[model samples]
Target: MTTFHAAEQGLAGLELMAKIREFERRMPLLSEEGLIRGSTHPSLGMEAVAVGVSLALRDDDAIASNHRGHAHTLAKGADFGRTMAEILGRADGYCHGKGGSMHIGVKELGVLGTNGIVGAGIGIATGAALASKMKGEDTVAVSYFGDGASNQGVLAEAFNLAAIWNLPVIFVLENNHYAQSAAIEDMVAQIDLSRRGEAYGVPSFSGDGMDLAEVYELASAAVARARAGEGPTFLVLDTYRYLGHMAGDTEIYRSADEVEAAKANDPIEKLLGQLIAEGAITADEWESMSARIVADVEAAEQFARRSPFPDPAEAFTDVYAKETQG
Candidate 1:
């Protein structure tokens, strides 16, 4: 748990962060319990970026996400029970159980989609921004991808197009230090992903992704820029994830000591401590909130467990691959 300025900002931010933290914390257990099918990637230690950025936007603003995007969808106002049911492959999921964890999205909330393919959603978001601009809508489109996706050529193309056309888009890179097993430093010559956007004449900002306030401030500025017709802004968030690439990842790449060290700076824990110190929430209040969150998660779990699976006849219903012009 984290507590910096949690009391001063009121309880909404604290509540959102707590929900994200609890959601990520329980996902792995759900996988272990055989409740989630296929593979599920948990964003255990990177809740702040999702909550902060989501908080900075209006409900009508759109965002596209990467594989580890449950936090993003939830923070953006997607229903928890439906998301849980989706993860469990239930009929009530956002995609009616077709998307599983990696491809879930709630269109009503303005989440374009979560892409399992690396860097895929960047183009989708760029297109969304272009559409918004053409329609004279003030909506801002955001693409949330990991550090690995930053290396993809599609990202550069998206940035170039958005910059040339002055489209209202934001490219948010959640640089979590690892592209699954390999340390980021070993994989890329430049770890400062924000600088990559600077080459295309796009404004760039970098900050501590663990600090919710910092993330919110930067995201707010970027959102404002896009809404003002200032084109795209590239933001690189330096954050970390507590879990391995996937549920069954042996994590042979990193040591137990390293993970333990990172746990000391757990974002939610930091906020909780700050809130109490600032007299924002009493100890009892925090405990009560935690209890409510636990109950909510348990209820979602029950809903997911009891929900029926999708009908086999609907397997190919939503499947489509539209041809793109060259």
Candidate 2:
């Protein structure tokens, strides 16, 4: 497998990370305008983890995401316009506007779905990995969840199953310090989440999620191991979210100082600065890139706004599968 350090791949990853950031940054405004109806979780500061892990995988490798999943979905190669349309409840969405932001599943992209239920993706991804193994495919599956999900029993079960069956799966824990209003410390007895996978004999690793290079390096190793039939690996990515747990959150649990401190290590800026320092990209190129990303996001918004909503009669259609004629 090729590493993300290659010049072209690095630049592509940076651009994708920027696009994910810009896309989620526009969410609050859409929410305020009532364009997004439900609770939308923004993965503002966690772009590096998403892009890094995604860049390590092939298009056929599957991924299951949690509520704060826009980054994961987009990073996994979903269409920007359709993602925005889904959030806006438009008919052109991946789920025909029925699944909204939390339930986007693009089978063609191997993005199994972005679930609303906490820790649910663990089982889904594990099942996907099992299927791939049963089919004798080399593809691996990834499950993305937050620090809060670390405490869920499903994680332990998935770990055990993946280990015993030698299924190819990667469990990525984005430890962003807080689980909604509750801090990670208050929610779990073990602060170092990387050790959670050790009990089940799954090799675990931890890294700074803000550093895209570090994330990519670690994820590449994990992906390689899984593809080699070495069973599952768990990654504890220490990152933080700049936004609230969800839209309309008062954010009373964390201090303003804490938020500002986390913003200082903004992942997008971190990678951008590194690229400039290494002479890989000039400031002018970055400016141009940012402008193009912003324009793309705006166009997606317009597309979602112009697209029609799903018809009421269609709700019952996709719910059940119709029998095929023999």
Candidate 3:
């Protein structure tokens, strides 16, 4: 494994990873406290993948995400308070409280939105890439989905169109081993999901999703390739989710031992250790940074709690075009 020095990379990566961890750690509490009305899939253990891939993209690049996408949104520069508000269905949300946890999106930030369906966001990302090519823009679109989504036929369709048309897009498969409750081993004949891209003549890569630096390096290359009009790439990320599929899942599918083993290599903690070993930050400094992240997340939580819900009369405002004929 390569070591990272804070002097060369600055502390932004470490900070973002910590922030994401803190944000996810608090997500379960939000549900337990009844702050969130609906279900939410936490990206607790997969912060590195989201942060690394998002940090590799340009400001104008677009992204489509799965249900567990809070980290993706935040890493892409969305306001945490507004995202929290959206999850809480408050008026100050990114979607103006219309779209909840499963559909929070901010177009200004190039977030196409998160989808509840398994692989639906792949098509959205492909469509965004096509639009970018049509407009002659250099925007690259990324689709973040889970291993469970890899089986969906839409993914194959997206791969074919993107390859033939040479659209600027990237398909990031977060292979967390389980698709809801089903293990990926039982779902596919071949274990490697990246082969799907190879079949479509697209560049395919698989790497450790828990390593931030590795993910960023691979994602940067893929983003560069797509921006250069070389077509799309498929990146299979080996990651894990600490929590169950949803807030109230019984989690009878996996053992606690398995989850604990994954936690030993916690990406956030690994980054912090590297920073400390490099003398870029002291142990106390690391604690201070974590404390600040905690405060920031708490502030966002309070902001969501204090915000009012959307008014019922405004429901039909942004839904349709004004010029539509009856």
Candidate 4:
């Protein structure tokens, strides 16, 4: 059994890396053939955020992820097949094909929903934490957003409430260093994004989000503090997004050398290397795992492809959580 006590041990070294690679390899295909519509934010280089946070969270703990959130939903234990189907607008998807890639969630699984608006879900998580406090539940709520979201005024407001009320919430800033096309430096005057939380008096810390062990460690501390009623903790996850902002991005803003530089320290590669060195996985065994992941993703795509899209009329029904009209 994986003990949550040691945050490092919470993450499964080999298996987690395999999942990240699987998604990275398959996401391109999804876009190429038009299976996934709208903007799909590939968490290709930022797998550590999903895997690390999921490992640290209890089954009942809640989460709201960014628009680029496939890994976030899957990391929290949502069925991959269903998520893909949701992206494809199939009836079998997480939201009966209504939510699409931006709105993946299972309330029972404590995934509130990934919001399409930047930093909007921070408020959702804050609200969930308040509800938990009211119900006398110890469960914590987490919100995952990117550095770009730091610019949004709503985020600052959410942090203030979480701090003043001492709500059980963790705000994870997945700082991939780019807000759309511009780099983090150009986008914000303060590069240390975690410092933003200081205004709310929320204890804030940054971490190497590309490292599973590091992210797990930081998240465990944040979650524990929240559970102990110490209020919110803002965590800046220093990571990278391998793909462009969107599927059709020209990506000419940055040099190819910069991409190469980021890839040089690819999170998946680092994790796999560490596992191999530690004797947790051998070369041939690792190769087998890679092969299996590729096959599994392909099979999942096939399943999504075969699934039927929901009836067009159903779209109007699920758009809002409405009651009877007089």
Two-way lDDT contest, 1 vs 3, winner? 3
Per-residue lDDT tens digits of candidate 1, residues 5-108?
45444366678878777777788788999988888898988988888888778999999999998999999998888999998899999999998999997889
Candidate 2 off by > 4 Å: 1-3, 322-326
**Clash pairs (backbone) in predicted model 4:** none
> Could you estimate the TM-score for every candidate?
0.94, 0.97, 0.95, 0.93
lDDT of 3: 0.88
For residues 1-326, write the lDDT of model 4, one tens digit per residue.
12333224422644665675586557667778788777677778888888888888999999988798888888888877787888888998989988887888788789999989989888899999999999989999999999888899989899889999999999999998888898888987879887899977999998898887788888888888988888999999999887888777778878888888998877777877776677766889878877887788777777888999888878687677678899
lDDT for 258 (candidate 2): 95
Top candidate by lDDT: 2
Please rank every candidate by TM-score, starting with the best. 2, 3, 1, 4
Q: Compared to the true structure, candidate 2 yields what TM-score?
A: 0.97
Worst 10 residues of 4 by lDDT: 1-10
In model 3, what lDDT does residue 150 have?
Answer: 91
- Compared with the true structure, what per-residue lDDT tens digits does model 2 show for residues 1-326? 34556376578889999998889998988999999988899989999999999989999999999999999999999999999999888999998998897999898999999999999999999999999999999999999998888889999999999989999999999999998889988887889888879989999988999988888988999999988898999999999999999888999999999999999998888888888888889999999999999999889889999999899988886776689999
Best by TM-score: 2
User: In model 3, what is the error at residue 160, expressed in angstroms?
Assistant: 0.6
| Residue-pair clashes per candidate | 13, 0, 0, 0
Q: Which has the higher TM-score value, candidate number 2 or candidate number 4?
A: 2
lDDT of candidate 4 vs native? Answer: 0.83
Please give, for residues 251-271, the per-residue lDDT of candidate 3 as tens digits.
999999999999998887887
Clashing pairs in 2: none
